[model samples]
Target: MIQKTLYLLLFFSSFSFSQFDDLDLTPADSLMQEGKIKDAIIEFETNYQKGNRDTNYLYNYACALAEDSQFDKSFAILRESLDLEIKLNPLFDPDFLNLRTDKRWNSFEDELISKIELEYKTIIVDKEYAKKLWKMRALDQAYYFQIHLAERKIGKNTTVVNTLWKVKNNINKENLEKLEKLIQQKGFPKKSLVGNNAVQAAFLIIQHADLQTQKKYVSTIEDLCKKKEADSQSFAYLYDRIEISEGRPQKYGTQVKYNKENQQYELYPLVDKEKVDFWRKEIGLSPINEYLSGYGIKI
Candidate 1:
């Protein structure tokens, strides 16, 4: 119950992302969740063929084919994904376990990541720190979000929080130092100057930082957002989280707290509850009711 709530919260957390951000998955993912594997495979393959070999579509198509027991076809699909320069998940996904016994698995796995590095190498013209920060911040999010799901068969739920925290912390320190200098030398790290991805990376680093750290540049980020340089959605989301963590009410209803006894995540107190939906709409967030449907929330 608590675990399910965590998953729901995680799902809703994406509400804070930019409206223009690429969705990680699609409705076809629900077909897989519903155990209609064949339907999912067909949909994934259709999407892959329709797009310009969108690696996301390609990767999922490969996973679905493997689950359907078509190893040869699956491997072929994965090769297309690699050629598309898809970033591979390091921890082997269970969907590909069946293909792991093949002798070629080791080399294919190595080559997949090598190709991702090659792709990164191509992003060095300008805002190179943006690309570097983007990769680090995204990996940090994955590690933080996957913590609850990491468990052993011994029934003990384990975590890699410390390990992930160390990595995130070091990167955050570097980002903070660079950002402070950037603010003094120029203005805030904005799209015209630092590039869009770097600004996004800056917001991501601040989101995971402690309150005192976030406070140091909250106004600077907000100013950039007003200039239409940084993202307003990200700014509001970070502010809401920081306020909630400090026992203050959230303005956007973007944060929630788990109710252990009820086995759910209830909305955290809001500063102006009636205005939340209005603000959410202005920022392109879905209606709260629609967003909370996964948790069986009505109000």
Candidate 2:
């Protein structure tokens, strides 16, 4: 019974972690981008009233309210966010500046600090230090995607080639070295040794590694999944990467290119076009249409 309870907590925490982080800007998000704070607040606050639980939406709604000088109401919404245990750091946010003059701000920040400590304690759910390394790699993967996406955007502004990508590339290389040493000393950080979520993070980072680097760990990754140490999702992604690199069509349509003008995603070559969905289903992936929905591609 105790073991079952721990598994339940781990599952819930991992699910919440994944759900909140996979965010893309919505219409309300665009409103915030365009500085239409009131309109954005109206849209976000309406969702909140209907019991929307997305942390980004809640925090942005609070910020929009603050921008509209709705200090008291913003405080109310922010407090609700605290009940959700969302990561709200007051110091870095300019939106909360006006509320800082109020005495309530001090107490609110203290409550936040306590929650933040508790949150970390929860994330460190696994006893193995490999979970910590995987978390670092997960962060690196996220940062890598952000840098890559931002660099892609820089081209539209007619700037000299984006230099930050070079810096980020260097950082990735450094992380690669760190991971290499870790793998040599400890072997592939199988999700079985840590928590499933930690191995999920590890697989995510492995996806971002160079093709040769991926090749080195592919067998171990496959072996672990066979033993129930890792899930098939990352294996599908990693195998697809290898297939494409070797000049073969990928069984999984994990690779895609976006056509900005048409707002559609063009899938990479498939080993068997008609059988693509079959392979995806076998590996526990959603159908291509469902997967591409997040990219704003039309089905």
Clashes of each: 0, 0
lDDT of 1 by residue, 242-261 (tens): 78778899887777656889
TM per candidate: 0.57, 0.58
Candidate 2: tens digits of C-alpha lDDT, residues 1-299: 01001111111111111111223566666665545667888898788888997655666677667667787888887777657655634333435555666777667755665575477654333334443464344344323323334445565243433465555567556767777777787776765465555566566556666778889888888998888778877788788878877888878777666578987756667788678788889879889778767556543
CA error at residue 204 for candidate 1, angstroms = 1.5
Runs in model 2 lying further than 4 Å from the true structure: 1-131, 142-161, 259-264, 292-299
Candidate 1 ranges with C-alpha deviation above 4 Å: 1-57, 60-79, 82-125, 152-187
Considering every candidate listed, which one attains the maximal TM-score?
Answer: 2
